[model samples]
Target: MKITPGTRSRATLATVAAAGAALLLLTSCASSTEPAPEAGGAVAEDCTPLHEFPTIQDGVLTVAAMNAAPKFHALSDSGPFTGIDATLIPEFAAENCLEVKFKPMTGAAAQLDLREGKSDMFGGLILKTPERAEVFAQSEGSILYETLGFTSAKDDAYATIDSLKGKRIGTLSGSYYVEPLKAAYGADSIEEYQSDSNAFEDLKAGRIDAVAWQSIQGFNFTDRDEDYVTEILGDEPAYPELTVLLENNWPHTKGNTEMTAAIDDYYERAKADGTVARVLTENKIGAQAADLYVNGR
Candidate 1:
């Protein structure tokens, strides 16, 4: 009996130690800093994937866009998941009583994702040729008027298409220039990559004679790396325009018919009332000198 009575104190001490250890474990797992999205992870939100709508709500519309540097700037600190088109899409969503959510994916992935119903839409699609019509559906709007060019090392000679004859021209695979360059110059003249960053890197290293890209991107590249230089080689001679893309019969996602129609109507009204021009002016996206429809492809 005396021995049994002595055992309770030891049991109490053991229990207290066990409780302290459990508390320490819990505390160790608690983070003082909030968890952030994993690298290249999509921003988590409570919304359906793709441009699908389970039920029409006076709420958010989730959009996925390409993280094409400078041009799309979808993840910039100034406005994370927001840029020119990023700004416009949400405004269009709001006018239709929908809130907007942005998701960023690679350029090519975003294209396929939109078709697979992973995103509602993707921006920054340049019309290099008419064949794009067979893929994603294009919107009634023109997003960017890209000025295609060839960038070079600052000291390199400014070359023309004719000058670049027989030279190795680096560009992105499936880019607007890929096919045309092959057609005009020859297949041997085109050296393509999945991402232009590597191509630009190689160009700077003298691995390629020239690199073709859009003017805006050229300026951005120069800003980032001093030795890099660029010049307008020529407009994509035959296919030189860019436009926004939508899902086929876009705004047709279930329960979104009304929402889509409203956007189309709003754009038409904005053009007629000049609200669109004012928006463009405020955004510094440059002015549309004429109706993009008539003057642009």
Candidate 2:
């Protein structure tokens, strides 16, 4: 083309502007598009719907219990394995929308059931023992406070622990009370029973002098039946503390994260809003009948 200063300048300026626009468009196109996400993989658009947690519509909660009377026991078909802790546990499970199932087992069997996943948790006011801490997870706070003491039938002769030194004492096999009975009398002093109700029956039948058992059950027994009367003795052998026991102990199971989180959330809300103490009081259970998660001493 012929070189003309004015016409060439205007034409070059327009051409240069058009070239710059083309480059900008190419850069924009290159920067805007990303590689397609992997097929059948996680993506912003194709993510599976998230189901709400603690929604136990189809989940089953297997609870194992030793049936320790008023604390937890199977009383006929109507009240089998229903006590302070037993009842409360169902409430919690229902709160999480779970189906409740109870399995009453002997002490040794209960331990086995816990480890083998036959039961998700155990019922009653169990003490958090170091040995048990290895196999089971204890509740962060106590659900019930049970006193260990002796109960006697009305007009029974035995009044003191010394009086029952040589007398037969009824207790559960592989229970915390067994050690105390053994310590007080001798290794073979106690008449061990797999069931607390059976032991209490034997006690009423005069097969045993005193039934060393949890105080709440003793109270329930004496209150419901006039024949059996329970009195609080000095103190129990191994100091009873009532708490829930899970199948997995301290570290807990990796799969049980949902269950554990639900329990923790329940207690956290309970502690914050006085529901913890209210639950205890409503059931007429626990010693102090106050917020258990808080420091009492």
lDDT of each: 0.46, 0.49
Tell me how candidate 2 scores on lDDT: 0.49
Mark the regions of model 1 whose C-alpha exceeds 4 Å error after superposition: 1-60, 74-79, 125-129, 157-159, 233-297
Clashes of each: 3, 5
**Tens-digit per-residue lDDT, 100-201, candidate 1:** 445565556656665666655555434423555456544454433444556777676444567677788887775656676787678988888766578878
Compose the digit string of candidate 2's lDDT tens values, residues 1-297.
111112211100000111111100000110012221111111123222122243222354566665654455554322333344554555555444344555666666776767776677766656555666666665454443333546677676344567676877887776666775687788777788877678778887878887776545555555556666655444333422311211211222225656666566555555466554544454454333122223222
Off by over 4 Å in 2: 1-58, 73-81, 156-160, 235-297
Clashing pairs in 1: 59-99, 60-99, 61-99
